[model samples]
Target: MEPLNIQANQLILLRLPSQNIKVVKVEPGSIISLGKFGSFRADDIIGDPFGFTYEIDSGMKLSLVDNTIEFDEDDQMGAEQAMTGHKITATGMQQLTSEEIEALKSQGVSGAEIIAKVMEGHAAFEHKTEYSKEKYLKRKKQKFLQQFTPYAIGSTELIDIYLDKDPTRIYNLSPETLALALNMGNIRPGGNYLVVDETPGVLVAAILERIGGEGTITLVHENEHPNLDCLKYLVLSEEERERMIKTINWLELFHPEESEPVRTKTAEELEDLKPSHRRQYYRAKQREENHKEILKRADTCGFDALMVMTLLDLPTLIPQLLRFVGGSRPIVLYSEFKEVLVETTLALQKENRVLAPTIMETRVRKYQTLPGRIHPLMTSRGYGGYLLSALRVHPNRAVNAVGKIS
Candidate 1:
């Protein structure tokens, strides 16, 4: 395996002190501006290892630093002092005016120096309670810190980026739901999967990452072209992209014999064509071969697993999709609402083509993990979506005393 580094034109996640994330394209020789947090040359971060937090100096030079403050078990007293629920008056806390702060920013002072200046100018610094002081310091640090952490783009982080920036782009799919789909589908290296993704490639990207270019994904899409827009953010090489994923229209999957007949040209006919016409003819021939392969795969109906994250009606969709999945293979379906999965589960039970259909939901609650002040955050996501999973099976025939179709 190769050491992960920030590569040019790759999408990297820059997490600021305020915990806000920005997805930036690393273009060498370009300057990436982070508003008041200051700007740095893209070359400064390129070739650096991912997952390192760097602080920008007064001269705009980058230095590796540990941005997170670790709270040890021995710091219980300090933690208690920091969250004592004491309120302090905001007035007279600092004497620096907005103009003076702006001047300090313009002077290119380091974040630490600027913070120290503000702290020194605060008139009521000694008057505030310890908890209030700590809170103020934290808020100010987040506001004035000229630091950013670059994280390697993976499925989880990619989902987080979209969740923070535009949830609609990934169809509001949560990380927990995404992970459940992969696990319940039993994705593995060298396996063949049938996927129906309306998340526009987030699900597919996750699968690709899990399989690590060793599996095949036949994506069934309703549109003329597969909407794999989210794949643009992933750092897949050309060979991996070409070898791991194949797209087929839903109509084509349902009607495999509808593809056009392949056209073959004799040597005489090829010799008579112009150069451009000959190129066009070869391109068409290659496409025809690819199309035949896709149709052949669809006709086989023996995918190792089936994973779906689409808005299509599941009760109708799952049964139809299961026909292509091999016996005893897993089928995992994801939806934002439980009612949708509940209906689909009931339908699957009636079809008897699946075994032990189950509807599952998972929710993750994040806490503020200070030593002695641990508690659930004031705000958190309400839901993480639902998963409906079952194994494809071939039902045995019923008879009075011998096997027969019932």
Candidate 2:
């Protein structure tokens, strides 16, 4: 793993107290705002390791928070309170007004102090059940806490940030589904892969992590150019991208020269171009040659695996890519709806082109794991969609069993 310190100009995820995540580019001397929560100088956090949590002081200064810190009010509340009935009072549930809270802010009150003040003002706070009081305090802290945690960017972080911002963009795919897809696809280092990723690039990003930038990925895209926008979130350089990633559109893959009109220039013609134009010419020629080489290899040797995550009609796509997938290889498709994959699965079965076509769904529900307080967490992600997977095979061949007809 790379050193986990915050780097200058690196993209990082800042998770705020309100459970809202912000994608920020850390530039020295600049300040990133968390709306009403607070803002901190980017330089203040530079060089810190990944797991430190920072609390913003009134002067915008940052101080490290203890990892084992607990709320004062919460620590005082006992489980016995959970069984106690409410004691009704004329002051009602809460008496703090917005104007008063703003005045407290102007007085430079910290978030914990503000929470304590609110608890004190609530006439029925102690009378309420422990769980109810805990919820109320937590909601207030989420709103008022001037703290944030910075997370290093990775496949899981990108998926979470993207899912939180726009689930539809990533086919509502979850981490569990990505894991399952990768396991089923058998992605590994130094393996050739054919993929069609329309989650713009989330699926491609996942594959790269598993492959470890050691193999080529022939990403067949729908548009004129592949949407390699994943580079925005990933830490790939131009050289690494050129080495491990190959992109081809439908036209470029199937009708190579017809779409590009590759014109060969003689040595004499190359000498006629200016220095800058000559450099550009050679780069374009190299790209063309590389594309041809990848296509030829896929055609002759076939890819080790095939994975796709797109809304395109699968019936049309499977035939084009399956031919390039070697026998006994895996083909995996991800769809937000099971209905979309049903048609694709049946067609593959009818053609006898694959074995054991299966549709899988992985749902994860987390719980509070503290021994006595164990139960499901109140909020959990209900997304991950579905996967259709099968192994490519040559139906024309008959195989002999190694074991004696078990």
Candidate 3:
């Protein structure tokens, strides 16, 4: 059998007994070890272009360094250092049975000792972030307790719970993390992009950080009254804020017959207009200005492309959305579950105008266990969602199997 190959920008998912996680490995094996559960050779992990799963038939030998047991060493020294932070190293991973892990837990063993035993097998473990020894101890305790069981929730349930919480327990991505995802999406500088997202400030903040050149962004919402209160946290320069174009009540603009047309006086016809007619024209012009102001906060314009990241029912929104994105563009949709996204994928396929739309999922896994443990490793967390991408084809072209309108 051939060894698995890993690729850049690829979404990787690893499911462990404790939890599932998703992550995009931007760099090859940069200190990604499971701490004590087990470790892998990062150099060996990077060269696999195709992903594979395997178990070591026998235990592998790891290089070890001796530590001098000295008296008067500050207990806080190592704990304080952990406060800075540490990365996972792909070395020193040992596979133990679950029975071994259970025994340690039953003995009231400390998590620090467990993590240390797992880490001692690797030499690449380094501290790069600021960490305090005390905080590190607390964190390790949490990690030990968190490994007890896995928590699973549906997408809707998660959204409902998170939205209601003042200080949510959910770990959401920041602008930097979102930037990483955007790069995975192949977003480029100086390109017009369309965005439909509920988190206005967060979405825009991420875009500003990654977008370069003179590219334009069009933000869309359900109505002229955009719920952009969350955006207040995104501090933007006066000049940069002015560059954004907005549109409000997206449904009204895209839905036909929602806008009423008013007659305008051409130069040839103006000569024949009476004073009374001229008065009506001026009044209509005033109304237009008033309407524009009411929607100003939510209205953006001059979009060279389209993207939908907002919260709307896909079944109802897709038809209306199709009208906005004529052929020759790309539509990328993100979902937390395969079920919610499968409908959209099928809808695009029925349209028969989409190109080879790709559907994929991603996850990140961490292997960690204590010395003399039975379980080889445990999973850390689930960190990815589903992705469906399709290109809008123009009228005069062939559509692919996944629905690409050429």
Going through the candidates in order, what is the number of backbone clashes in each?
0, 0, 67
Q: What are the lDDT figures for the candidates, one per model?
A: 0.78, 0.80, 0.45
Prediction 3 global C-alpha lDDT = 0.45
Q: Write the per-residue lDDT of candidate 2 for residues 109-137, one digit (tens) a residue.
A: 77777877777788877577657855886
Predicted structure 2: lDDT:
0.80
* Per-prediction TM-score to the true structure, in the order listed: 0.83, 0.84, 0.45
Instruction: Give the candidate order by descending lDDT.
Output: 2, 1, 3
On lDDT, the stronger of 1 and 3 is 1
RMSD of each: 4.6, 4.4, 17.7
Which lDDT tens digits does candidate 1 get at residues 1-406?
1239988877888888887888888898898988877788899888988878888876678887743552122232554566664233335555788788778876867566667677767868768765675677777888877888988777888798878977877768889888888999999898888889887688999999889779789888999889887777887776787678877787667775776655798999999999999988986676556556655654676888989988999998788877788889999988888999999999898866898888898777787665544567657776578898899988765632374345
Candidate 1: which pairs clash? none
Candidate with more favorable, higher lDDT: 1 or 2: 2
- Candidate number achieving the greatest lDDT relative to the actual structure: 2
